[model samples]
Target: MSWVPVAVSLGFAGLTVLACCSFKVFLGVRRFGRELERTKRRLGPKHAALRDELHDLPEPRAARSPGDGVPSV
Candidate 1:
């Protein structure tokens, strides 16, 4: 019965450490997510501009003759 208190104390300490580590990891992930959102926001306008520029470019045509694939009469 004497060892029970020691075991309980050790278990509680272990759990506390585990919880602290988990909370730290959660905070880091949250910070990373916030930074990622900020980056996307900053790039969104540039991405849209580039997309518009691409849309304004002329389309390329195939090099083959128009009647090359037609069947003989």
Candidate 2:
């Protein structure tokens, strides 16, 4: 039928568009992964320093009693 060629052409065009979109998405994901790795590397030392500082802090005190020279509502 005459419509068969038109159908085949449309199918090919659709596939081409889909493939291009897929490639673009793949590249974007790869770039994002690289940026994430770079950021992690840059902040690794700062993160470790903050973690160490947190550990060096003193422990919390026990809860105070309301009757310790204070009024108990």
Candidate 3:
């Protein structure tokens, strides 16, 4: 029938659009992931240093004297 060719053409067109859209999404996700990784790598050392410093700090005590200039809030 004449309608068969039209149906096949429409199906192929839909498939092509779907494929293109999927490819774009995949590429965008890949790019975003790479950017995130790079940012993490850039901040990794600083974060590690901060963690070490926090770990090395002495625990707070309840016997604070005057002139400590530290706020208890």
Evaluated against the true structure, the overall lDDT of model 1 is: 0.96
Model 1 Cα displacement at 46 (Å)? 0.4
lDDT of each: 0.96, 0.96, 0.97
Give the winner by lDDT: 2 or 3: 3
State the lDDT at 35 in candidate 2. 100
Tell me how far the alpha carbon of residue 30 in candidate 2 is from the true structure, in angstroms, after superposition: 0.5
Can you write out model 2's per-residue Cα lDDT over 12-46, one digit (the tens) per residue?
99999999999999999999999999999999999
The deviation in Å at residue 11 for candidate 2 is: 0.7
**Alpha carbon lDDT of residue 48, candidate 3?**
100
Q: CA shift at 31, candidate 2, in angstroms? A: 0.5
Which is the leading candidate under TM-score?
A: 2
lDDT of 3 by residue, 1-73 (tens): 9999999999999999999999999999999999999999999999999999999999997976776787777
* Model 1 lDDT per residue over 23-65, tens place: 9999999999999999999999999999999999999876888
Q: What's the lDDT for residue 54 in model 3? A: 100
Which scores greater on TM-score, model 2 or model 3?
A: 2
Angstrom error of the Cα, residue 50, model 1: value is: 1.0
